[model samples]
Target: WRRKNENNNDDPDPIPCIALALALLYYFRLPTNEDNVQRNDRSTPSREEFGDVLSKYIPGFVEIIQNELEQFVNTDHFVIPHG
Candidate 1:
């Protein structure tokens, strides 16, 4: 099936990377005495949360995802943006 084409075998993927990064950033982003809401109930992040991560922790990471999605719209990679 599709399993044969993968680059790495039995490897952890982006889930843990993104999750741990967010958790660490979240822990540091809290106010000195404030508590974060329980994360168990919030499986999916809100758009604002994604924007917050992009703005505070990792900029252009989101834009990288955007370009990935845009690839589906235009497969011709040679297109010039300004021309």
Candidate 2:
């Protein structure tokens, strides 16, 4: 993929996008409130709010993401081949 991108003068890679997505998911899963104080700043949306926004853009986003993750984990991509 890198070679192809380099040959075409395209951007380096899409790994950052995947990393950002995973980071966002992890952030949302954290509790919004801790010890009666907001865990995040006012600008940051809560998990429910983020989910609502995602659902508006992609209907059934949660289910779709969950299904895709499950599929990936069960596929050979997640496996380390024996030597």
Candidate with best lDDT: 2
Error of 2 at 51 (Å): 1.9
TM per candidate: 0.28, 0.39
Model 2 C-alpha lDDT per residue in residues 8-73, reported as the tens digit of each score: 566564443343374366634644535225444666556555555666665665565565556555
Which pairs of residues clash in candidate 1, taking residues 3 or more apart in a chain or in different chains?
A: none
Q: Each model's RMSD to truth, in Å? A: 12.5, 9.1
Worst 10 residues of 2 by lDDT: 1-10
lDDT of 2: 0.52
